[model samples]
Target: MSARWAADLALGVRLALGGGGARTAWARLALTATGVGLGVVVLLSASSLPHMLAARADRSAARLPVAEAAGGVDPVFAAGRDDEFRGRGLQGYLVQPTGPHPPAAPGVDRLPGPGEAVLSPALAALLQSPEGALLRPRFSQRVIGTIGDTGLTGPNELYFYVGAADVAGQPMAQPVRGFGGEPARRGLDPLEVLLVVLGATTCLVPVFVFVVASTRLAAAARDRRLAAVRLVGADRAQVRRIAAGEALLGAFAGLVAGAGLFLLVRVLVPRITVSAFRGGIFAADVVPDWRLGGPVLLALPVLACAAAVFALRKVVIEPLGVVRRGTRVRRKLWWRLLPLAAGGALVIGRLGTEDARDPFVIAGVVLILVAVPVVLPWLVERVAGLLGGGSPAWLLAVRRLQLDSATAARLVSGIAVVLAGSIALQGVYARAEGDRPPPGNVRVLATAFATGVDGARAFTTALHALPGLAGVPVTTHALLQNAAGEKFSLAVQTCAELAVAGCRDGDVYTSDRLAPGAGLWSGGADRTRPPQWTIPVAGHHVTAQEGAALIVTPGALSTAPGLALSVNATIPAAGPDVVEQVRNLIGWHGRVSSLGTERDDTSALITRVLSVGSVLVLLFAAGSLLIAAWEQLRERRSTLAALMANGVGRGVLARSLQWQLAIPVAVAAVVAVLAGLGLDWLLLTLLVHRPMVADPVAIGILTATAAAAVLLVTAVTLPALWRTASLAHLREE
Candidate 1:
């Protein structure tokens, strides 16, 4: 029996291959392979993730400095300084050797001395670029070397090591003897795991749908061919095996094509500079795990074969003609809806405090997502039945779809699932990011340096000198109080700094409330008096601005004995990079923030990814849809030709083709959007316990994107429609 099956399968492959000059047969095979290949690539990419993550983790672990090892060979004072430039994060280590033979940094040749630095390739390039002018001053140390790949997980990682004279007292600094340690073993929190699972699962589902659809592309033609084979005395079981054999060839070819495609994408991964990915991945790390890959490679062909065989169950190939069983068989609504209802109920849970990790919840979500395509055929059939009253193109399209709405629905299902998933994810993502706080017009930075008055003056001068801060007025004031146990407080600023105070540059202005010859504490108003200066000549008294504290220009304190003033620099409307530059100048322990403005890097990254990723993934669905349309065109070439023979213009046939695909696509998009919104609302309100704040912008983008994808598919299939409409095909039909 096995030998007989093999013979029948071999015959089927040859028939599918069309060893003779069979143009239509070869086209169908190629289309099937291309569709399946695209899906295989996605599956391979999903499987590669584990290896990619593990490789990255291993590299990250290897580069971590071991803090305070027992019997260390050599120790160095190390501190972590995480900084950002133009939204790209850079990891830096401040190193100070504590021993004669200090260990070198992870990728550097040796430990850096004071005034020297080692930079990553990416950072080195950025520092040399014209765009890095604002960031250049932040790393004032001379570049001695570049970090090697061994120390970096990603090619685009911004990382470096800079020499520090002393890191002993700096925040987060510690003594480290070597670099090598296991990465943190902490797993993701419950909510995070749920998000990850949902994201990954939702992403892969459409690919699988596409693959299943691909297996049965041009099924009508294949079934007719199988009927001809039956005329040549092929048994029913042999016919099934023969069909499976055809699918096996396409699936095998697709597997090879997918591997090549996967490799091509892997090569391009390093070039992706998305901030959310934290620098792009290394091509070498983007390997598919054997355990996952072996199964995937094997399963695709098997699934393809199975799908082909299963599709044949809907049609019986007799010696006379193929008879499609499902045409007259009404699709039962009860069973189709049972899965959706059960999935929704399980997924939604009991609204209150159910854990995200609940097995039923996750399974329920999966079932609901999977059920979209399941109920889609029925939905499309109903939609098609209701669709009426239009041009000949529309009427023809409606009639054709009403004949085999299931096939049309299955093809549209790929994008529908993706669209729905993307919308739900976007809603959750938007809520997760939260609403950004309204930014203050003025840039408020409170930076305190341990450096005395001379350092303070130099810092103030430096802030004025920054090119980015050109034309920006900077106002700084320091509190100067009396030491003679006087009750009044004083603030010092130049006339240009504050127009309200109106103190001239060299004016020694004092408020009318100031006591005569009050002794001032030069070191500020502290209990322990370091030194005192007498208000020698209290000449002019001006109106106090608002309260007891009064303004004095910096020139007023120039000649004061033992002068020390803590300054607060508030540069109104400072540029974005100016804050980071200020942060660099202030270094560790300094506080810098814009009042009322919040910056969440993770949230920002997620927003960026969602906007870009949805568009990218939609492209995959578009490819599948395009192949489906082409296959349908090839299968119905005779029909198109017959229409043309009946005096129907090519333009009308073209519009008919468009209508056929568009109606189902439009319905699918609407269903997807509505389903996504509903799912997002349920998840947010019940599971996540957050308000459903639907992002209209994201929704609009997703809708427009899906529409664009459909248009693209429709446009690409036009040539096929034109070719299929040739009157010669009528004779063939």
Candidate 2:
């Protein structure tokens, strides 16, 4: 606010904008701005995700049939006949109106009439494809119309509504007055909450680390510049204000750039994710959560200013000059480990409960993950000091690291955090994917209720007509009770139908001779009634059925007049497509599923979220490392140039650069892997209470990513190294 402070701030801003003797200032500023910008894009997108998913959920819930509404003045009978073709699942329903003027479902102008079907655009396309040959039998009804976007959660949904004379085929059919129901919202269970928390933390923490690192770029050069200002009679406070201004300039630019990038992503993402590869959302859904977005807007500049000013705290910038401290004192280790230790204590204290989602446990997990970066500096410093090699390139890198390893640590701290967090999250995801019920032996089944002998016969004939079961061995079964109240299940077929079980036409079977007056009931166990006929009094039983209970021929049960029974037809092969084809046969009366679809969807969701975050994290980390490499070059310009002038080959300098970053990052990667698995194991043993399952694939992927980042930094900086080491630039400061 004061004139002096204002003057000093303006001076620092000009210096950062490259007005002073700093030749590499423009590159440094770009690195900071770019770092902040990338972080902003990810943060903004993460904030918008909840709102986007909620919108998708609302659309999905809008079309659900509400059976409770069936009793309203106007009603329609509805049954779900959802099916799958190939590996792609589809939504479908069979409906018939009980009254005139029945309400239409969402996305359709009119309710379908008997013998017609309304299809979604994607389904219509599929039906026209050559692959539809296998699916055409299931939707034999005439195509009268198509469902619109209003009825679908995403553009590529396969959905249909077929008109039927009656909804008797489905077990869940009931009259529904109309279709809208409340959104099917469910709160995240504890494991889900844990995942969300970890997901958010992993994404944002690295950004903050990046911001802090970016603001402190070219620390040695900044210190020297401040010393010159001190020599010119500017006091400590004014010098500090100048540094803060320079940092703020980059942060401000980043904030603006980030806002622009976020908007661009909103427009581009929907267009790119247009199909089933990943579900696409409407542009309207990409609105940020102010709760998270607001802080990112407010904090970046503060972090920049604070990191710049704080780095100056230990350096005494006197009028004469200051010796830029690299390793005057040994790095401390105990305090660095304190957060991890304390957080672990808190988690262990709360073990065996809601610890997965418990705030204390979450806090502990954060500390442990964050500790990867904190402990990294100490680890790198110690390891770099002990490292030795005969190779000239390796010697050059190690000697320099032995002088100032903290720089090496900062170079990959963001990388370590991102990788460690990713591994822990992946472990939990693998566990969730595996925790499913086993599949059953029956691949396809069809069932329906029948009211009379005639109804039973019709249902039986319909079972025989079920599409996709041609030439497949089929058995029709029913559960029945006797007049004496004993219950048993029966499988009946013509002897021709029993050929699969080694029976011929004219084969006959009999049951144990019952007490006088005891006979089979026409109804099932759920509906016991009087005998349809008395037990036979004959002393002889038929031998053509081998005296078995198998109803190899219908004549076995025909003697009991009026044998009405419900029906179920089973084909018994649990191979691929068997369930879908069989389930289509039974239609709405029963469900055919392996329950694996939901698990696949969940896995896809995890992949989509984490895969994007991992990429962003990689880009952020790699870019930051590249900047650090450039900063090192600028700081050592005098040394590197003099070495080149003395005939040190460019190859040696390049290999040294590689060794400098790779050494520390390699050590950090191992530390990261241990810390990540340790965190994952703790969560699993205590919170998830599942077996400890480590994902080697996750570990390998993240480790390779970190290595790639290190390699990228070295490769990109080598070109800059040659430029910095030119003969014309060889001058001692």
Candidate 3:
């Protein structure tokens, strides 16, 4: 901590980094810095996402003015339209501003006047296109300005903001409140948070592993240098300080490079939009917050230094030579199973409980993922020890792995995690898609919205006219004025339909006062008082109260003043095209959607996200594995040269390298696949009780990809191995 000591440490760091004019040493240092820098970049980018997304949401919310104060109540009027624009369906909003637009809102130059609208930049660009002109007339509005990062539209979606007066005479079926002063919420939901965590974990895990692995790159050379320093009258503390200083220097350089990379990426993020709920995130939202980013940058160096210190733990700096102290206590295989056992127990326990949150399940899965690497070293050590004697190449590779199982395990850890994630995601996707009804048997529930008794009859007639349609049930509701002239909505459906729809006691009613052929009436009478008549439908014996008279048939619909007509029909053998046609036909009158469409859409989105994450993780993992392999080969050059001098063929050495890489990878792949499937089963059992389905194709692809990556990395490093095995390397040694 003294000034003299600090100056000495600085001198040592400079000498270590300068590499005493050795180009190979400088190159190793540069590669280490590059690895650390890349890791830092990914970490910072992932950390910034939530903040960026929230900022976009805030900007969009700010576009709307505060709600007007209506005496004691705040009056907020809003309208939305679901229409196709530029060949894409979008939900558009119109808000009644109580005051002028806020200047702080992004992309709004001024408040939109009646018949004038503010379009998102994407929508504006589309509207200005020649193809967009053909659709412009239908919107009947002038685009006054463009909004950027509104957060209400996707990259391909069309979203426009207009004044409430533009939609004054139009019916606003759905009301949007809470758009006033501050947006009620600004953050990710539970599922979104889970996904973000999952993505970040997947991305940054490999980066961290690479960074740690990078510190140990050329470990033999580092140990020799430290040993020389010890022989020159330096104590253990001084040697450790010098080594830490070297790591810190590389890490600091990496942090700077990473910061530069992040800034460059920030500029490009605005151009790339990823779709999710509330539209997708814009580039502007992805800019790293310095508060969070600063810590991440600072942590990288600390972690690098710590890893360096840890790697040096077994290395003893003696005057004679560097002695790596080997552990007397061998790691037991059962110790590795503890995490998996605990995680499985947690998952099983959670399944017995009702309303378990997703985070708990994610935690359980994470535990299982963590166990893969934990158990790998022991497994590799045991496997390599058992399979030590085969061909000369096999014996050489196995003995090398057995000698340093920890390093062998580290090489394939990334691939293990990625493989496990892919398998688990495949299981989840299978379970989700399994619930989807088969084609031709997919039920289509068509709902038609119309007004008046005549409209109900017309809608029903149109529904029945469709070929291959069945269960053409129609329900009509009226807004009735009571004796006090107070109006309330009442649904008119027969007792049979009400029973089938699972209406509760107070939710359904029948009356003897009604004509024999009339349908049942509900929800207009006071719940505190009894009605004049109470009767049950033909099938159920439980119904007691008759709030109002029934109008059983469409012929009796005209007796009451009908407010809205809801006609339901089912198409059992409809194809997607036929279903689309039905939807379009019903949409001509009102909003229409088939049953389970929303659920299916959500499941598909989740599947896509998981699949993408798995692919990215695999790519990153492969890159890390390649870097580790190259570094390992470089460190083992002297050993390889010695082997070559002892009559070992280049081909045998090459095969040995491949086997060394392959042994850990093959073991990790099997463990990962099994762990992945188990995790998937636990997740599904806890969430939804769907049957377990193994995806052999996905498993095969994952295995083949991991194997191919190992082979490719080995092939790429073979030239390095050949050079290391030559007389030049032996003479240098």
Candidate 4:
């Protein structure tokens, strides 16, 4: 290489290394790099799961079309009556005329004669048939061509085909209206949404943290160089370029490493699921979408450099007549720091105010993390002061903390922030989920109901006559079609009885549509059509059991031929006798369930998960704390020797160290409390239905753990500190 080219390369390497010296700076860089790498791995892996899920859903969905009726049959009923039809023995079907359909019985003309059915792939799986195969749990038909791939229905459902006779089996006998209504649509995939949020958080948050940590490290080093340069007659602009260049180089290298790791992770994720494929011939290979990979790769390095450049902007400018003895806080430039503090506060506020239901809440929280460093310095100073006293070792540690408050704040703040932020979020989630209204008391939903007005009236009267069941409202519902060709069901009960099912009901109950009472009115065109009315069902019914269809009045479905009218009861939490008494009156065939059981099961699962996650996080924190603490301990050898010479006891010295550390953690607890409250507000206002009830026990455990760690670290260090102190006395010989 030419001399000039070699010099340029040398300069680039020097810039990248900054003034921390290549070897030492490299170690810090490596740690930061590791964090970045881990973040990328999590981002690439977890984020990619959703795409895989969607693809799986699509592949599964491919065999099924949106459940629909033949052109000759009313599509309106087909679309609106999926739940009703499914319950009445209609199965899921794929969209293809060539597919097999369910066989008809000897007298059932509406059933497919030989080989036709309409069913989703899920149904097919249950029946052990290929897509578009006829379901003959009772009979048989020849398997025909399968349904063509379409991205309309949910995965792995049964799909069948049938001619005009298919609609005849429907209990409803209303004359078929023209084919028109809401198309069968898939709801947003919760898994996909989770993946997207996880991906975005992993990618963006890690990168942000990596850049912030790296930038802070880089800028600190550069400032030392800049200070030296100012003494040597370098101009501000010249100093700034050198600092900027160094930062840019470090960032570029980190980004390159990060991207390489990111790509490797992306390639490896398909393999995680590959093990599950188990001898399948269809190889599950995802062509890495460069559409995604390319942008991430290109943007990461650029982002790294930009982050470095931004961080260094302040330290590059030299203050006039500034000395390096004390921390430099240029009075003239104090206003600049306000922006940083303000920026952090704004981010925190935004996250706090966000609708927790939105996935963006994750992003906001990650962004708010930047505020950690801004707040950490003040905390460290207070904490370090609390650990005072001069047994040589203790004095040394204190002096060190006092001397480089900036660096201490920068390094330790990340750890503190990780600890605090995690605690705050988890604390809030635990509280909110735990304190949520009991499923029975909060929702007042009926778990089981009988069909038909007569059944509902009799059921209501029977239950009301029983002692202790007077308040129980048996919500009645009807299924019907509107003039618009829309199908609906009503959940009807007296307004006072709405809470009996765990929901608030107006005099006219309707579906939960936001439009003012549209939930109440139904089935009519302009002035000519007859008004269709349906009652609304709420509480446990809406929250849990109303999965397939809306709760409605018995009169609604009565108009449909062969339709069964049922009254469903929202049972509250009570003794077995109370439950059985109601059940005896309704008969054995009535619908029966308790939403509280479902809620309790769900809550138990969440508790287990949170407990597991907290353990893992604590382990990570403890390990990191030990390593960092040990490193600090090693650096205090000279001070320890001095303290030992003065005859300071090892026990006292250990207590001092413990005291200092405890101060910061105590501060962190306060921060956690504030953050927890903020989180509770966010959850109550934006995410959940009730005020959060933080588990005092869980919080106590966490507090105890943190306290125990402080004491344990102190206890553990005493032997070592004593050994070192004793060695110092031996050195005196």
> Candidates' lDDT values, in order?
0.74, 0.73, 0.63, 0.45
Off by over 4 Å in 4: 1-29, 39-207, 215-253, 256-369, 390-396, 415-437, 441-662, 675-733
lDDT of 2 at 116: 84
**After superposition, candidate 2 runs with Cα above 4 Å error:** 1-11, 21-26, 68-74, 97-100, 114-149, 164-168, 183-190, 272-278, 319-322, 437-592, 595-608, 630-642, 695-698, 716-733
Quick one: best TM-score, which candidate? Answer: 1
Find the 10 residues in a row with the least total lDDT in model 1.
471-480
List, in order, the clash count of every candidate structure: 0, 6, 9, 73
Task: For candidate 4, write residues 282-355 as lDDT tens digits.
Answer: 11323335566556645654565466556554443454443354554422334434634453444445444334
Query: Candidate 1 or 3, higher lDDT?
Result: 1
**Where is model 3 poorest over a 10-residue stretch in terms of lDDT?**
532-541
Assess candidate 4 and give its TM-score to the true structure: 0.49
Tens-digit per-residue lDDT, 1-733, candidate 2: 6988888888888888864455567777777787788777777888888887777778777788786654434677788765566656677788887666777688988778788889887788878998676577667889888887778776666788888885643345777777778864455655666677677778877888888888888777778788888998989899999999888888988888888988988777656533343435667778999897888778889889999998887788988888666448887899999988987887787876764667888788888877888899889988887877769999999998888787889888988988888888888777766675554555555555554334556655655565555554434555456655666545566755555455654344445543433566643322345566444443223333432343434544556545545565555554565555555555544445444234445446655676677677778778777776787787788889888988899999899888888888898899888887888877777766777778777689779978987887788788889988987676644
- Tell me which of candidates 3 and 4 scores higher on TM-score: 3
What is the Cα-based TM-score of model 3? 0.71
Q: Rank the candidates by lDDT, best first.
A: 1, 2, 3, 4
Q: Is candidate 2 or candidate 4 better by lDDT?
A: 2
